[model samples]
Target: MSGIRAVADGLVDELKRSLPQQRKTQRGNLALLVATMLEVRSANLMDLAASLPREADRTDMRYQWIARTLSNTLIDPDAVMAPFAAEVLERAAADPDGIVLILDQSKLSDRHQVLMLAVRHGERALPLAWRVEATAGAIGFATQKELLGVVAPWVPAGAAVCLMGDRFYGTADLIALCQRRGWDYRLRLKGTLTVRDSSGRTTTAARAKSKDFYLEDVELTARRAKTNIGIIHDPGHAQPWIIAMSDNPGYGTTLAYSERWGIEPMFSDFKSRGFGIDNTQLRYPDRLARLILVMALALYSAVSTGHWDEVHHPTPAEKNI
Candidate 1:
C-alpha cells in the first residue's frame, strides 16, 4: 500500500475504535479525507482529489465525491468531533494545573468567520468546539453562548478549567457564563469599559497604570457584572493588559492572559501554515464548517503521531547533549 493509504488505514482503525456507532462508509470517507489532508497539507479540492486513494478513474469523480461528503448535512461536525475532544479534555484535566481553554475568532474568508474554543496543549491548542458564520463582523455572544453550552457537558466532572480570551471575548455576558459554569478565566477587557471597584471608585480600564495593579470585587460595564480586575502594563507594550478573573487578581493571574496566544498559532496552522484552509473555494458556511472538521481531525492525528514519535524516538535536541 502507498504511504497515504497506510496512514488512511490507521486513521480508519482509530476512528472505528472511537466512533463505533458511525456508519462504515462515513467513517472510511472521513478517514481517507483526513489522511489525504495530512499528506497534501492543503484544502484545495483538485489537489486532494488528485491524491485520493480511490478506485475512481477520473479525478473529477473523486473531487465530486469529496464535495458530496462535505455537503452532506447528515455529517454533524459536533458529533464527529465529540470523541476526539473528550480525549483532549481528559488529558488536559489530568494535569495538576488543570485544563486551560482558549476562545478566539478568526476570518476564514471574505464572508465567513469562525469562533473557536480550544483546549491548550503544549504551546498550542486543540479544537474543542466552534461555530462558523457567514458574516463580515463578529459572531455575537448568542453563538458564543451556544457553542459553550454544547461543550460544557463534555468537560470532565470536577475538573478545574481556566478560560482565556482576547478583548473581543471579554464581555459581561461571557463573564457571567464563565461564572455560572464555575470556570476560572482571564479574559482581557477593552480599555474603554467602565470599571467600578468595591469602594465605588469609577474609572475606565485605560486609566489603570503602574507596573501591576489588582482591583478586587469590581463591577464591570453598564451591566455591572461582578469580577476581579488585574491590570499589567509592562515596558514597551502599546496597551495595558486589562484582564478580568474569577478569582483574586494578582500578577500571576493577570499574566495568565498570555496563554490566549496559543490560539493564534493554531489558527495559522489551519490557514497558511498547515492545511491552507483559507485558500479553499468553499463558500457555504455549513460546508466550510465540515471542511474545518476535516482539518481538525487531521491536526489531532498529526499531533498524536508526533507525540508518539518523540517519546519512542527522541530527537537530538531532546536527548542529553
Candidate 2:
C-alpha cells in the first residue's frame, strides 16, 4: 500500500466506518487514485497518475489494481456518504440557533455530466448530498429526500428547523411534506403557480389576470427589504397578489425566503477555486461522489481550523460545524 494507497486505504476505511451498513470496498487503490486526481484539480488520467507515489506508480499495480478491485462490484456512493451528512448536519441541527438547511443544487458540466451536489453555506462547504442529477435533470428530488432523511436524526427532538430552498421547489407536495414533518420551511415560490388554500377552495383570480398574482413582491437591498404590490404582467396568466405560509403572517414573510441566497457565495467558492465540482470530468456518479467527499473533507478541515474565513479575510464570520 504505497503511493496514496495508504492514505486512500485509510480514507476508504474512514468512510466505511461512518456508514450504517458494512461496505465492501476495503482495499481500494484506483478508486483512491481517481478521488485524488479529482481533488488535485487536474484533468486526464496521465496527469492523475503523476500524483501517485513513485513506489506505487505502476499503471497496472497501483491504479489498475485498485480499479480491478472495484470493477463490477456494486456500491452506491450515497450509501457511503450518507453517514457523513448525518454526522455533519446533525451537529448543525444541534446548534442553539439550529441549522439553516439550505437546499440547492450545483451543476457539474452540462456536457454529459453525472452528479449534482447540494452543499451547505459559508466559506466552508459542508456537503449535504450528491445525486445523479444528469439523469434527473435540474433539481433532484430523490437525492434531496434521502439526504434530508439522513440529517433528520441529527436535528434534536423539537429543535427549530428552517429549510431554505429555491423556486424549483415551489410545490404543494414539498411544502406539505415539510409541514407534516414539523420543520419550518422557507422556500421560494414561482409567482406563476396558483395557490390552493386549506379550505378545499381554489381561486384563479390571481392566475386569470396577473402573471404574478399569488406570489409576494419583495425588493431587498443589502440587509433590508421593501415590501410592495407586484404587477407581473410580463409572462403568462397570473393576477397580482402577495402570499406567505408563516407560523404567523406579517411583513417580510415572503422576503425571508431570500435568506437562502447567503449560501450562493459559498457555492461560488467551491466551484471557482475551492473544489472542482462544476468542472468535473468523471464519468461515473460514484466517482463523482467520492471526489466531492474528499473536497468536502478538505472543507471540513478548513471549517474546523478556522481557515476558510481567515484565509479569505472576511470581516466577521461564524465557524461552520
Candidate 3:
C-alpha cells in the first residue's frame, strides 16, 4: 500500500476509537482527507484531490467528494476536535507551571477572519478551538465568549490555566469571563484605556514613565473591572507592553505575555509555511471552518506522532548530546 493509505488506515482506527458516534463512512472520508493533506501540504482542493487515495477514476470526482465532506453540516468541528483537545489539556494539567492558552485572530481571506484559541506546547501551540466569521473586523466578545465556553468544559477541574492575548482581547468582558471560569490571564491593554488606581487618581495606561512598572488594585476603564497592570517599555520598542494580569503585577508576571507569541507559528503552519490554507478558494465561511478542522486534526496527528517518536526512538544526537 502507498504510505498515504497506510497513514489513513491508522487514522481511521484512531478516529473510530475517539469518535465512535460518527458514521463509519464519515470517519473514513475524514481520515483520507487528513492523510492526503499531510502528504500534499496544501489546501487547494485540486492538489488534495490529486493525492487523495480514492476509488474514483476522475480527479474532479474526487474533488467533489472532498467538497461534500467539508460542506457536510452534520460534521461538527467541536466534536471532531474534543478528543485531541482533551489529551492536550490533560498533559498541560500535569505540568507544575500550568496550561497557557493563547487567543488571537488572523485573516484567512478577503472575506473571512479566524478567531483562534490555542494551547502552548513546547515552543509552539496546538489549536484548541476556533470560530470563522465573514467579517474583516474583530470577531467581537460575544463570539469570543462562545468559543471559550466551548473549551471550558474540556479543561481538567482545578487545572491552572493562564490565558494570554494581544490588545484586541484585553477588555473588561474577557477578563470577567476568565474570572468566572476561574482561569488566570495576561491580556495586553491599549495605551488609551482609562485606568483608575487605588489612590482614586485617574490616568491613561500610556501616562506611565518609559520604564518597567507595576500597578496593583487598579480599576480599568469605565466598567471599573479590578485588575493588576504591568508596564514594560524597553529601549527600542515603539510601544510599551501594558499587560493586565490576575496575579500580583511584577516584571516576571508581565513578561509572561510573551507566551502569546506561540500562536503565531501555528498560524503560519495553516498559511504559507505548512498547509497553505490561505490559497484555498472556498468562500463559504462554514466550509472553510471545516477545512480548518481537517488541518487541525492533521496537525494534532503530526505533533502526537513526533512526540511518540522522540520518546521511543530518539535521534543519535538526542541520545548522546
Candidate 4:
C-alpha cells in the first residue's frame, strides 16, 4: 500500500512539473486529484474521495473537497492535454503502419454524447481529444466534422492517417472533410445505399455483393453532395459489410476497417471496465468535460505505468498505452 502511494505521489509530482509556473496555486489540488485517481483506480469524483486516506495535517478536510477540487481546478483542458498530445504524436511519427485515428460517440442516457477522437495502438484507442454535446441519438455532421477538425492539426504532414468509424459517420460530408485534410478514411456504409461502380454504373450496394470485392473510383452521395468513393465488401462469417472511403478499396481497406473495433475497449475502460464514468450523476456538460480531462490523466497514467512495467515483465500483447 505504501509503495502504491509512493508511485501515485510520484505521478502527481510529475504532473505538477509539467504545468505552467503561473498555475502554481493549483499544485496542491492537482496532487489530491492524481492521488485520488490512482487510489480509487476510478474517474468518479465521489469514488475517488471515498478511497482517499485520511491525511495527518489536514484535519478539517472533508471528502466533498475532492469533488470541489475536481470541479474548480484551475488547469485548462488544453494545457493538460499538451504532453499527451506530444506523446501520441511521437508514437504516430515512429509507427510504420502510420497513425490510425478512430472517431466514435459514447452516450449516457439521452442527455450526453461525447464525440471522441482516439489514436489506435495495438487493440486500444487512446483518446487524444473529444467534444461533449448535449443532444442525444446520433451525432450530427457539423459536430463530427468539428471533432475531426480538432484532431487534424496534430497529425504530421504527409504522414499516413486513416479515420475509421461506423456507418453513421461515413457521410459524404465527412468523407469530403477527410479528403480536404489530405488524410485517408474508411467508413462502414449502409448495405442499402446507392453507389456508382468503377464503370460509372450506379447500383445499390446490396446488388454488388460477392464474397469479397474492392471497387475503385466509385461515387457516394449524401445530403445531395456526390463524392468519389471506394467500396469494399468482406463477408467473413458475419453479415456482408460494406465500407466507403476516399481511397481505393482493397483488402488493406477491409483490414483497416477491422481495426475500428479497437476503440471499443477504450469506451469500456471509461465506463464499466475502469472509471465508471457512466455512473456519474453529474449532468452539466462543462463539468462533465472537466471530469473527462481528469479521466484522461488517470488513463494516461495507468497505461504509461503498465507499459513501463511491461518492458521488464514482457507480458502478452494486451491493451497498453
Candidate 5:
C-alpha cells in the first residue's frame, strides 16, 4: 500500500497545483482527503479515515477534520472539478471521433437524486459535472439545462461533440440549446410525442410506421414548436425513437443512442460496483453534493491509472476477469 499511497499523494499534489490562488489554503486537507479516497476506494469519510496510511495521523480528530472538509461550504465544487473536467475534454478532443457527452440522473437514496454530465470513454462515462437534487422525482427542465451549461464550455473549439440522453432529457429547451450551440445531439423522445412528418402530416411516435424518416421544418404537436428531426425505428424492437436535431440523421442515430448505456456502468461504479455511496448515511443535500466532488476526483484517478496500465502492460491487461 506504500506504493499506492505515494502515487495518490503525487496525484493530490498535481490537483492542488491546478487550483486557483484563492483556494490555496485548502491544499493540505484536500490532498489528504483525496489520497485517502484513493486508498480506501470509498466515498464514506469514516472508511477513508480508517484506511489512511498507518504512519500518518489516524486519530478521531483527524476523522472529524475529514468530515469538516467534505461538509464545508468554503470548498468550491467547481474549483475541485474544473481541472479534471478540462483534462478529460482535452484528451477527448485529441481523438478524431471527438467526444460524447451523456446527461442522466440516478437516485442515491429515497430523497436524494444525483444529476450527472459525463464524457464517454470506452466502457466508462467519466463524470465532468454533477448536481444533487433533493426532489423525489425527475429533475425539472431548468435544472437539466443548467447541468448542460456547466459542461458545454469545457469542449474545445472545432471538436465534434455528441450529446445523448434518454426520454427524460428530451425537452424542447434542451434540443434548442443543442441547436444554438451547433452541437450534434441524439435524444430519445417519449412514445406519446406527436411529430409532423416530411409530408406535413402529424402522427404519434407510438403509431408511426417502423421506418427511417427525415423531416425539415416539422412541428411537434405535443410541444407546439417547429424543428428539423429524424425518426428511426428498429424493426426488431417495439419502441421507435424520435431523434431531434438540426441536420440529417441516419443509422448512426441508433448507434449513438446505444452509447448512452455507458453511463449505467459509471453509476454502478459509484455505488455497488466500487465505492459504497448507496450505503452512506449522508442525507443533507449540500453535504452529499460536496462529497460527490471527492468521488469524481477519485474516479478520475482510477480511470487515469487504468489507461496507463492498458497502454504499458498489454499482456496482463488482456487477462480480464
Candidate 6:
C-alpha cells in the first residue's frame, strides 16, 4: 500500500518536530512505530519486529532496523505528539474549509467504558481529540470542554470553526460556551423544550411562522418539528445565538441538523476496523491525554491511506499504525 505509506509519511513529517530526544527513540523511528503498528496489527512486539522491512526488502534503503530498535525502546507515543498539536491546529486554520469536529462517545462494553471522541467530520473522518472514561455519560459538558482545550490553541486568530453534536449538547450552558469561544455550533434539542421567542409568543413551529423569531416552552408537533426555531439572548453569554437551523427550512431547521449524520460511518470505521486502538491502556489523567494524541495520528493514517475498508471485524492481530 502506497496509500498507507503516504499517510504514515504525513504523520512522520508532522511528528518529526516534537518527539523528545531523551527517550532514546529517534523521531523517524517513532514515526515508523505508528506506520508499523498500522501495517502490522499484531500487538506482540516480536511480530512487529518481524514485520519491519529490511534493506533487502528495498534497494536504496539499506538496513532499516525498525524492529529491533522498536522492540527495545520504551514507546510513549503521547510524548511524541503533544508538542505538535498547536502547530497542527494552526495549520488547520489555513484549511480552506474550517475543520468540522464531531463530538460523540463510543461504547466498549467489554470494559464497560465510554470514550469521548472528537473526530474530524469530513469525507474521511479522522480523530483530532478524545477522552476515555468508565462512564457512558462522561460525554457531557466536561467532554466538550476537554475537546476544546486541546484544539483551541491550534486554531489561528479569526479561524472559523464548526462543531457537530447530538442532543447531549442541547443544554443552554454548552450552547453558551460555543458562543463565547466564537465557534459555530450545531446542536439538537428535543422537540418539546420551551424557549422564549423574539415576539415573546409562547409559540412553536407547531403554531408559528418565519415572521416570528422567538418563543418559550413550546410543545413539539410533527409540523413544528421541521422549521420550528427559537433564540436565547442572555446577556451573560459572550455572544447571542440563534437556537436552531434546518435544511428543510420549509418545515424548520431540524432537517438541517439531522443531516450531520455524515460522520456516522467514520465512527463505525474506527470501532469496527483494523484500528484496534479502541481502548485506553493508561489510567493517569495526563497520560491519557497523550494517548489521545497517538490516536489522532492513527485515525488520520487510516483515512488518508484508505485502510478503513481493508478489513471488517478488526482485531489486534489484523494490523496497526
For candidate 6, the per-residue lDDT at 107 reads: 64
Q: What residue runs in model 2 are displaced by over 4 Å at the alpha carbon?
A: 1-47, 58-76, 111-125, 140-143, 196-245, 251-253, 269-272, 307-321
Clashes within 3 Å, all models in order:
0, 7, 0, 0, 0, 22
Could you give candidate 4's per-residue lDDT for residues 1-321 as a string of tens digits? 564466656765777666646365465566556667766767766566655654633423545666565577465665567677667766876788789889888985468888888889778878888777788778788878776776677677778888898878877788778878877787877766666644554444554454336665556653433443444444464555567666666666566688889999989988888778888877777667777777777778778788888787775664353
Model 3 lDDT per residue over 1-321, tens place = 989999999999999999999999889888999999999989889999998888899999999999999999989999999988999999999989899999999999988999999999988999999999999998899999999999998999989999999999999999988988888999998888888864565554554663427888788989998888888888898878999899998889989999999999999999988888888999899999999999999999999899999989999988886
lDDT (10s digit) by residue, model 5, range 172-284:
77877887787877787776777765555546464346453665666775665656666677679776777766556566655567878889998998887878787888878
Instruction: Evaluate candidate 6 by giving its C-alpha RMSD to the native, one decimal.
Output: 11.5
Instruction: Assess the local accuracy of residue 118 in candidate 2 as a C-alpha lDDT between 0 and 100.
Output: 43
Candidate with the larger lDDT of 4 and 5: 5
Query: Which candidate order results from sorting by TM-score in descending order?
Result: 3, 1, 5, 4, 2, 6
TM-score of 2: 0.64
Off by more than 4 A, model 5: 1-5, 20-25, 53-60, 197-201, 206-213, 310-321
Worst 10 contiguous positions by lDDT, candidate 2 = 220-229
Off by over 4 Å in 3: 210-212, 316-321
Leading candidate by lDDT = 3
Candidate topping TM-score: 3
**Selected candidate, larger TM-score, 3 vs 5:** 3
State every prediction's TM-score relative to the real structure: 0.95, 0.64, 0.97, 0.84, 0.87, 0.59
Runs with alpha carbons beyond 4 Å of true place in candidate 1? 198-201, 209-212, 315-321
The true-versus-predicted C-alpha distance at residue 299 of model 1, in Å, is: 0.8
Better of 1 and 3 by TM-score: 3
Give me the overall lDDT of model 1.
0.89
Query: Residue 126 of model 1: what lDDT?
Result: 93
